[model samples]
Target: MRRKHLLNTFAAAALRIFMLLTLGVMMTLETKADISEEYPDFYTGAEGTNTKGINFVQSITVLAPEYCSSVMGDFTVVFKAPGMKYIKAFCWRQPTDKNPGKWGHDAVLADMELKEGEMGKFVVKGDEFPNGPMTIRIHAKDDKNKQDICELQLYNLGGVKWNQGIPDRDPPGAAGMARVFADDFDGPLSISPDGMNARYAAHKTGGGDFSGWQFSDPHGENQPFAQRDTFLRIHASKPLGTQGRSGILSSLRPDGTGVAVSIPSYFECRFVAQSAPGTWPAFWTLTKNTIGMDKNDPTFEKISKMGSDELDIVEAYGGYGHKNPNSGGVYSSVSHFWGQPKPDWNQRKLADGSENTDFKPSSFRTDTLQLGGKSSWSWTFHTYGLAITETDTIYYFDDIEIGRHPTGEVSKALPAWFLINYSIGGISGWQIDMERYGNKTDMWVDFVRVYSGCVQAPEVSASGFPGAKPAVVTMSASTRGAEIRYTLDGSEPSEKSTLYTSPVSVSQPCTIKVRGFGKNLKPSPVTEYILTTPPGVQGSIGINFVTDMADSEQALAPGDVTGIAPYIQGNWNNVLAGTKTTSRFSTSDGATSPVTLNIEGEAKPEKGEPWGFSGNDRRLKRGNLVSNPRFTLAGIPYAKYDVVVILGAGIHNVQGEIHLAEAESGNHIDAFSFDYGWNGGQHAIATTKPGEAAKNTNYIVFRNVTQKDITITMKWGSGKGWTGVAAIQIVPQKD
Candidate 1:
């Protein structure tokens, strides 16, 4: 991978250091005794460093419904606590992780009149909570407000079977997508030598994360990771007092190669954690830039052309003190953009440097979501998910979308590998109190899964317009391994429809509907096209710039004037100049025009797979600063026609000028500048939602131009710019 620029790293690091250094001061102003008020024994920041002599309550022990027991129906909590005025019980439904401070109860307590002498029994129903791990808190307090709280850890198997492991249900908004990867941890997570067959690695390749202080491999004969009973447990502990050791499982292997999900993809993890003080647990993904890579590696070349990015699906910091409240019940979804142009939303700063503006760091952004209602993630296995499309990145908790942002440019450009880890207090200012839990904690992962974006809709094209002669129509799908199905009568195409193996001939005007299907994938959205001969002169041409030499070259199509629509490639940063092409452009009148096109100066071709677009629609030629590429179209039959120029750079945005002129006379026809805007870069395609037709101000029109040949020149806009042209069309204007 390309060596990360140190200037960007130091600039972002300086901001983080500033936050760390000022956290204490911020805490002083924002910290309140959110938990200490209920439990006087709960430690808060010391003011005098002296102990209070108040009377304290003794310990209580649960006698029935043992720890880790799976409860399905009604159950009684029988505990023992003598010399107490009254005892009360309530289910604090532990957060996905356990902490020492007081916790809130989700299930109501019963039989409040019961006394401790009678062995306190409070009836409760196991069905009151969702199926997952839970915690039952027993409280006993004296008149002096000093209280002793005890908790019982167990699982509630009310709605789900005990041995079923992680649920196999698909997440929301996953329609039409296909599962690309899945692991339930039913077997051991062993490391393979080359990381070819192994599903995981102990750490990221080449030694990154926590600076060697955490996620150590084989800590003194005790591996920090243990997989069994359909769950992968990551144990965190302070083995040497000052050093925090734990384990991490990455999709990347030791050789820096492993499973990665590309955009238009979804990744998710279902897990429970111990949200105790000082514990940090997370489910996240990073690009190859995070792993150690050699310049000669095959993938390194592709990665070198892109920037780095990180997607933190969930970051749960465990603590109940004033600085960290709600613990695992609340988590953050963060994204980092490294060594790339920052998105527009991340460009804000205090103009005068005198005011504190609500702005994220220049390199990162974060948003938090809470489970709410006294429920914490550590209390049970909750699914944390991330969906990445070309335009946006969405975060989901338990299948519910929590936050969304414009997809990072780097994220859209590169594939991402995932990681899960349990860390012991390092950077998350929340103080560690693991001594109460034996200086160790665990984060349980039930499963990790990945899904590719939906199969793109089938694109239909014709060799000639339907009229006096037969027109040969062809169809294609962008999703690999997908099968095209179609219908001639405009009916919805199903698996029972005619399977498309080759081009089909249409004798007359008719409607054709098509869809694509693949194994383990949701069916592609259905598309319908009407083929007919029109009086207006009509034709279109798409230019393909080679990025991957292995890609099959797409040929020029007749391109219907009635708008034949379907689907979506990005090339690297290099520019190609002086490319030429000559082709016969088919028209609606059943005649062909010999068109010769040539580009002068620098130009770039986009060939990467863009979501929701395919074939020639996915291709575009772009021009940049210093060289405005000019395309000369010769041999066009003399006629007064309206010329339409399609804009957009596939996944990238373009802001520049499109100038039309007579090729032979050198007389300018028209010229104007345009901007595709941020995030929503490709204006002609719906990169946010698959299969939806997105059309707006994505085309420029030069009306009633009388010319046998024309020249189109693309120049970068004044400020931030690149000029992208995907396709061009010519239609005769009515006299």
Candidate 2:
């Protein structure tokens, strides 16, 4: 990082922050296909204004997507620069670091001029770097300040050879890419006949040294990855030990992923530095273009030395405990390893004929970032990320950026495989430094999220009215040739999760979680839809509002028993303490005398018990309102339909009550009574219904709880003039 380029670079960086905040980007876990369509404009930078006459790179604006990790792909970046002659671009990880352009700060790498009159453009074709999010600093060759270039737009034509060898299903094969594969290494790793895997290693059949590492979950602990306290422990063996534990990519089959392996991909993972004298934790990727070497055999070293590309996102040095001296120091670097440096062919060999130190690309790191800004690596967990493509590669830490570079070297021009592991003694570094480190240590990883590939998850929407039960909802995806997978249990969807082939019928209030997947693309981010069906209700229920008749407005409407959005509806005014005298009328079948409430001698409330209705009688607040009749009927079709009335909370201290009703056939029905302590909630006053299922299960069933209907005149036997009320649920007893 240099001193002179601080203000200008950071200013541009500030603009990028603003863009990420306002733009809507697709935050994916597994991805493939077009990076631009999968995420947002943050991958290509902010759209610059038409303001021309610009020369310096400071005049350019960047608003790329928050993430873009296309390890191999072709895309075109279009820009308008009427007065621009030549363009030079530079990118360094640290905003404060000045060694930005790999070809110095004044080299012209991409030309932006064409004949007499034409807009300039930068084409990142298939022949580029490993993968994504390159922070480009472009300037005109003629002007010292790039002020002539105005607008910029990027259109990703999808990555080249994204997933080549995998057998594509016939007909509607893999129409969508739901989270088909992912492994937190939490529960026991499951190997099956269907070939679903999340953990892998090249040499040891995707399990590293076969037994060096183990997946552990003590039945008593509260974690799989419970923050710093508890997490998946990938413990390592002795130094120079054969095993290396890792996870992240799913294609490390011992059989090899032929040429054109994975599509342009985004790789990310969070890991705590190893704690021990002989521990080293790392997250890295390898280019698929390794033609001469075999990843598992001893001959790999010699072959890789000839020519190979590997990107080390993070490689912590050996460390012990949380101590600084034993840990991987205060910073980590993003290095690109491409064969040995010029004339360094013998660097891969050992004097004793035993494999020794291989050439370390420490001197050629694209960018280096200070860990926790001057903190030890093993002390905490940090995120390491890399987005690479054929033409450029970008690095990130904790979601923020490290820097980017052009595909200047040939090794960076190929697609790559991913890897995550805990190793002890390796090439140029970590040894069993027992003096400062502990003998046995473990790497605790929170979780790893790879944001590569693209899957336009389904967008859910509900249609029809709330009054209808078993609501009909549809799930659609914006990605072409995508299918939706969904669940109603509030759990995330995977390839094995329930597949949504058509409109869904939701019979209760539930959360509908869905994801979209395309043939070759990764699954889209999860989209949660909360669906609720308003209970079928009849006329409006009255309320006991404490407000005076003068101040309170229309709190109750005319209706025998109305219903809508919820189980009950009413206003407070109708239930005022002394607003209306307690009186009940007989059913229309026969003219029976009305009954008056026998007010108990000013009911005494327990000294400490607060009144259900709060506030003074003169004010119309929430506390001063109660449902009228202290109860109400809730159902529809107004005919002779059976149902059940389940007493809710409002009956705690209710006094005595009675009900006289006539059956629908004009015959006298059974009388009902309630003792002083027996009231609302936990009490079901069952009525006769047609056919019914087990009532023990949960569901807001409105049909089939009762068999017949009755009209009744119910009166309070004892209590103040006002009736205490809670909820009155009327579920249809007969479906």
Candidate 3:
């Protein structure tokens, strides 16, 4: 085992080395091509060093594809430069004499000051540019007046596909959930009055920020938020007065009025971390009454007396090497319950025996859970989710369970609104060394989504097959307190549609559509069913065979004996070994047939079949385990009937085998193999199966069963060597 482990480790190391080499080759080739075609003679300056040590701008490289088919969401830019004053991005569709290189001041998308050797990361919104191929140039300049520029082309599709490859991060017990709020940042950022007409508010309405930086426009006059490649870019740049200018988007407005979800809900965000030192990016939530409107609102009283809650779903601290150990690879999810009576940081307890006002932990319900990821948070995108249930608060990273804690008392009592922010060094003790990153950084968010329980689509079931006669169809929805509305004339079902009180009798051929609606819940998806009658067929012809020990009262068979397609019911008629009995079966259509069943082997059948087996448990799914049943049928009336044999026991994983052949001709007809545990092959009842217009699993139909006399042999396939023959069906096909 040790030798095998060593071999596996060596193989993994070799594979990683090979991948790195391949990536290096690809990047080298891409850089060469970009420099050769896109860069003009002046853009590619000589490597003669004048002031800065290396003159790194001559071969400036943007760590991305030179030509992107669809640029939606924020993309990272990594360049090599030993010293530079600033690096900026500009975009234009076509170059003209007025702006020959499309590098006009109007085309400037983002400009940031970078320290020596620090890369310039900016958010480029695709919609800000045109739809066709657009030229984007990244320009960098040193204090020595020496500068370098590189250009790349990108195609904008104008839409964000954020849902692609995103994992479903629904928490346990969060079933029957519906999306309540979603923001993909696919278009221009909308900043309305208190976020009333917009998805996000530019700044905090009540104005109490924990970070050293204030929430303002990082780009001076413009809003700090930008939509890039279907992502929200929050820029954090140079300081203003005592604090720096950063970006933050709050769901709550200035009046403390905004969208907020209650307890037992889920909130999630997919984002790429900034990871630059002194930068702090967070996706967190606060109680509705957290920051009231200047002590005038009644919510202010609640904050003073009852206190508020802060659920930090993710608080990512940036700093590669700093006093604080946290970096791009580690993040924390904390639940902070503020102390009551005019909440303040002084109320928090210090780590020492005595409490200190500065740099101390607050709230008795302070549960901070730190999680690590395989790669740096800024390297790629990752989803951070929080499931707030009645009893527990669960946190997830990339849909995988990370840490969980008990629900805070205050959090359970109040509704919460979310906030996404890019903060600069403040309360967090991490060093603010922006010199490495040129003093500017960015936080990118792919999307933010929240979900709660809502109305669910109704499951439709039919009593009989669609034909000349009426079929009673029942509609049932899973969501509690939801009302089901349906339409029979094929029109879309709405709240005004006919309320489903009882079973709907669908006569002739028609379409049935249903939808569920409830108070404070999103309506369910419209479920449609096209009911059609078979051509030239008054009714169907079928037969069902069960063991003698099985309950005869159960409606396990697909078609009823008295339905449009009458099916004959039969039993195995268990007797002594070598027993031969001729059972005459009668159909609802008055079709009588003589089926001579000659059992030559031992008939080992289980005792007393359970009732209600076919209703919820699916009849024939679990049944008696029998052995060695060789039955020969001489008289089959139909010239062409689909013979379906149910093999395997649902309760066990035993394999069962069945082979059928012409009795007189001794020619092979067909064979089937199944394992009860796997539920292999066709295993569903055709008529009652949902979305099964015709065929079903476990409904193996032998089309060319022309001969009347056929022999069926059943035995165990493999595994435990114990299998059961629950039932069989024969449906007549069209001539």
Q: List TM-score per model, in order.
A: 0.46, 0.30, 0.39
Error of 1 at 639 (Å): 86
State in Å the error of residue 107, model 2. 48
Q: What is every candidate's alpha-carbon RMSD to the true fold?
A: 21.9, 24.8, 26.7
Worst 10 residues of 2 by lDDT: 21-30
Give the per-residue lDDT of model 3 (tens digit) for 1-735: 000111112222222221122122211112222232222321222232111121222435556643223465455545554565556665542333565442212256667777766766666766544443344655565544334444443445662332333345544435556655667777777653234334566566455665556676322332566666566667666643434667788887643445566666788888765444567788888877654345665666766676677778777665432132222245666666766442233344545656644432321111111223233344446678887877777777766666676666676777678888887777665557564333556676778877655454566656554543456788876555679999889999999999999987776668899988888777776777665553222322323333432232222432222211232332222222233554554332224446565654555654222221222123333344367676677777767766655543334445555677898876878765554443332244323222222321233345547778887777554555355554444455566
Off by over 4 Å in 1: 1-88, 92-105, 109-132, 138-151, 155-169, 187-197, 211-213, 216-220, 237-245, 290-294, 297-307, 322-328, 339-341, 350-374, 454-735
lDDT of each: 0.57, 0.37, 0.53
Q: Cα RMSD (Å) between model 1 and the true structure?
A: 21.9
Judged by lDDT against the true structure, how good is candidate 1? 0.57
lDDT of 2 by residue, 157-190 (tens): 2322211121223111112222223334445442
What ordering of candidates by lDDT runs from best to worst?
1, 3, 2
Which of candidates 1 and 3 reaches a greater lDDT? 1
Q: How many times do residue backbones clash in model 2? A: 91
